[model samples]
Target: MVYTICYALIFLAEILISLFYFENKFERKASKKFLIISLPTAYTILYFARLFNITVVNMLAFFVCNFFLLRLCYKAKIKSAIFHCSILLVFNVTTEFVVMLFSAAILGTELLACLDNSVNLIFQSTISKLLYFSSMYILSKVSSNERRKESPATSLMLFLLPISSTLIIYAILYSLAEYELGQVFLTLLLIGIVVLLFSNIAVFWVYEFTLKTQSRNMELEYEKQKLKSAAEYYDLLNEQNENSKIVMHDIKRHLNAIKSIAKDKAVTEYIDDFIEDFSINKSVDYCNNPMANSIVNRYKSFCDKFGVKMNIDIRSADFSFMSEPDITALLDNLLENAVEAAQNTENGFIDFSAFVRKNKYLSIQLTNSVKNIVAVKNNRIASSKKSDAIHGTGLKSIKRVVKKYDGEINMKFNEDDMTFTSNIVFEIRR
Candidate 1:
């Protein structure tokens, strides 16, 4: 009963650690009660097979069981699930080996003999479990704090660390298990384990820091590009506005000339239709702010090129609180994404609106037609484009602008209507 209880508790702790690491990734399709009762119990039974002391059985029970439970509880890609399981198994097994090695070196015994001593078994087990839990908790917290989209090569490189670590640790353990240890050799082994642990941790820290720094630099460059593009667009709009003014100034004279030259009925009707189209589809001045208007019109031209209908209702909205560059970045990224998504549909349309609500909030909504279901991973809208890093940066850029204003942005996809919606509400500062 004591052994059974100990094994059950170990399995429970391991399962809980797995859940904590994947809290964001999990989509709980099973009932809580069912998972609560079944996961640990199933793990304990499967792990009891380790008592047979077969290497294959141990590997299956440790790594395969973890992968299976995670898959059963969470919806994830196969590669992701396997990578997660490998990390957990590597940490757990390596920590245990390190603790056992230390215990044997101190007690002057063979590796297996350390486990036979009840006092040593308790001491090593407690210390190893503590080390595993602390390491996993800290790792999960650090990883959860930032969302980085790793390239395929980067992910594969990261995966290699744990795989190599696991194989190295196992090989070392097998080498030392059957031999009696000397004081000098034992000291070398202890140093090796410490180096292994610290090196792996340092690599993780450097990789995360580098990725974050790169992402920040990219976003800054993107902001600069937004400002530059906004200036160019506004300049173009100014030129067009000037030409339109010149055309409208002589409109009466031009109309009289057209009417007089058209002698045939078909030519007269064709000229009339051309005149009506110019009158109805003239450049739309979306808002009073020149920068904001340029951003909207720029996307409107793209929408026209791609056969997407662009709707705007922001004439009454006030955006004086935001800087020119901020306005450009925020609207440019949002509308660009909306137009790109809408362009692929048969009858694509984007509805964009912003208005003042309660005299203190500016509410904005952008809804666009989508041809395919939007996928969400790790609580983020997964990019459908081949270049996920680029797509992710676009989202991060929008989020950065929203954060600067201390606002809220929510995105949702309506499957029934086949549309994606982005809703943002910003507190009015002026």
Candidate 2:
């Protein structure tokens, strides 16, 4: 009865560890009631399975219960669930094996004999659970924000520490499981094992720190590239607008002269038609600011070519406080992202509105259709781009510009309606 009680307590502790590790690391899909009922039920089943003393049955129970909870209760993919469950199982088994060896060596008894007494079993269980809990806690804290996969070689290198430690312990057990080592030797061996366990945890902490530093550096590089592109685009648009104005003035003078001297009625009618078409195709004035209008008109033409319905209601707003590069970066990225997402959807549409609110704040809102549900983390949507280096490039650029002007930006994705909306407000500076 004592052994059974101990097993139940150990299983319960493991359940808590699993819950902690998952709640912060993965997305959950079920309600609180479902989690409450399912966890206790899994705990009860796991407790009974351990009673059989069959390693295979115990392992199977552990894996299946955790796997189903991760796959059904949490939103883990099949492969991901399998991989996580296997890692937890390996950690549990390896920890228990190491603790048993430690307990047997210190107690001057055979490995199996260490479990014959409830006191010894309790001691081993408690030590094993503590080591398991500490390692997992560190791992969860370090890896909670990880979104990218490590290279195969990097993964292997990370796992090498624990794998090497486990192998060393396994060899020790196989060679001397039944032998009686002296107190001094056993004490030194126990210290070595403890250090080895901690070394594994330390590697994760160092790697996580290094990864975050690298990610920040990459984001800075991407921002530099975006600013450079925005400046180049602004210059190109400004020059094109100037050239178009000059060309239009010269062409109108020549055409009017030709119209007055033309002899044939057919030729006069063709000239009139050509002038009307050219005038109709002239650039649109989207707002009072020419820089803003240039970027907006550019995207409007893209929408026309791609058959995307675009609605614009940018009432006369002042942008004199904003730099030309800032205007280009803000509008160019916003429209480019919206167009790219909406173009892939059937009957895609983008509705954009910008106006001065109460004469002190400039309000801009954009809503566009999306083909798939976008993933949101910390109230920001993840990028749909394929490259990790350029992920969130547009949003980040917009955020930098907004911050420069003391503006506020809010983004929302309506999964049910398959639309994404961005709302930004900037206070007008005198």
Candidate 3:
């Protein structure tokens, strides 16, 4: 009873360390219910291995078998998983032997026996848990915190499966060696430990490769989708604007010819024609943001051809508020949204302005014609007329950039004006 209790305590320590570093990657939050179930489950696996009494052959099996078990726990099938697990096992087994040697040397036999003492089993178990935790934390080839965006639920499976696998493998070796020659048993156990250590290193190397490959593949897919969507929307959004530019270009030639054909007295007709053409549209230009200006000019050129009056008053003095690239990101999204809103209207118009306010804040606002803007997923604006989700991300991305600066964003739709307006204020960090 005493020995078992001490063993249980050691198991608790190991589980706690594994869970703490593996789950949150910061602190270990031990849940009594979880430990009650997992400790025995882990220990039972260890007992079977110890009971077998052989060490050499069992250790070899432990390395390869545990990799497969880990793969199974992770939703991987046997055949496909074997290829990756093979590499992993070889590396891990090799690493295990190296660690086991160091662990015995540093811990010393006296300390090890004390932790495994028969008299004070609980204390022994606790010490064992501490040793296991330290070993796993320092020597294991895994760092849970490094895996971003991976589901945490799967983390337990990943951490535990290897442990279980190692247990089963060692048990088989211990069992086989129990009936073998004493020298044979020792040789096999030593060899098995070495194999197990190297296998872990191999698996970790392969695991890292697999993760990086998956991430890159995901990014590639995203880029492909972005380019495809951009192609489809590019024509729809800018078609009318392109036509307007062509018309304006033609009108320039018409005015020039009229000026040449008429004398000063009759030139009044040409001047009136030019004024009527000019008076119909008024464009506002704000700051000289090369990137922002380029984005505005492209859309403005399109708006002029389509008869949308664009008024842009853009300026940015707080270079410290944001980097030049971030400024472009904000402007590109806002103007894109503004252009879309205005272009969808019968009498389309876009008003944009930016300046440092009285409170030493950089305020940027864009108002463009829109009929209705509804709220759908918690403070997210949904288009009242056209239900497009892509537009949501553009605005959301802008909001994200703002939040990074600890700034605020306000967006509302006015029914009377048939306009959507956004007010963003950046509190520049001094």
Candidate 4:
């Protein structure tokens, strides 16, 4: 009775931990693995501890086992494991304390025979540990592991929790009974043991199914974000290309005016006016290719309109080998996101510098001031509020182009300084 009550209490505590702390702390799926592998392991460790002492000894072993397991789970990243496991420890200690109090209360009144008391202890420990943690595991299945369901008591999950857990309780006990024989059993016994073990962990099947669904969702979201960002890139590139063509068309008009007005005074005035106007707008930047120049100038206009300053130092952007559409598509998205982030800040700015480093590479470095902490998901930036579906596309599209030509792209955000820097290596074919 004491063990069953303790297990129930611990189960409740773990559910609370999952809700308040572990839900959104790290990558959702990775957190789920830690929770799944830890519970059975922790219970098994305490089971072994009962061989020595129930309260202090078993708990000590439980703690040591939990620490080592968490270390392995996080690859020894203590900071991350602490973020997930601390809450669990709090729940464990609390439940153990309550079980101790309950034991004192019950045993305070009666002294039992040795055989009966021993059997009682075994039953209490086994059933209490089994039912609670099994329920905790089930709760984690739909709780800690879900993508964005942060609340603990969503009616959908709360309704199913007990039914699933009760089913698992009977299943795990029966399964462990069949495997009560030692590992030496082979042939029929071994096969029977394997089947039992599989059924006992029915929750694992649910977890796997959920993970498969999650991966499919992520892939679909990636595709959607990719397609959305591709449009932005294409549009940015197209506008730049069109701007260059229109500027060329105006060159003829400039030439005719210069030809017609050969009066020295009027020619000087005309030339001076043209140079002044060109300097003020400065839309035609020659240090880079016309396509790239047009995109940068347009992005600059966006920055200026949003009260942001931009610094540009780009050169040798030879996109001749790249299909006009491809080059435009790639550069447009990269620069637009940078521009957007920068524009969101007070005193925000974007800095861009590009050059050809070696044989066939266009190297670009872009830095921007950001408004909030940016999240990194599988090397892409996304927010918890924003699903991977829309937010992951821009980064993916850039990487797709980089992969096509055998190049590299890297991004990092500095939270303390609110700065985001990205580097892209673009390859041009010979």
Best by TM-score: 2
Candidate 1 per-residue lDDT, tens place, 328-377, comes to: 77888888888877887889999999998999998999899888888654
Compare candidates 3 and 4 on TM-score and give the better one. 4
lDDT of 2 by residue, 355-399 (tens): 888889999888998888777655466545532112277788899
| Estimated TM-score for each candidate | 0.57, 0.64, 0.38, 0.58
Q: If ranked by lDDT, best first, what sequence of candidates would result?
A: 2, 1, 4, 3
Q: Which 10-residue window of candidate 2 scores lowest in summed lDDT?
A: 382-391
**On a 0 to 100 scale, what is the lDDT of residue 230 in model 1?**
69
| CA error at residue 84 for candidate 4, angstroms | 4.2
Model 2's TM-score against the true structure:
0.64
Residue 360 CA displacement from its true place in model 3, Å: 0.4
Tens digit of per-residue lDDT, candidate 4, span 221-285: 76556556655664666575677567755874785578567767777676666645553234747
Best by lDDT: 2
Cα deviation of 7, candidate 2, in Å: 19
- How many angstroms is residue 420 displaced in model 3 relative to the true structure, after the best TM-score fit? 9.1
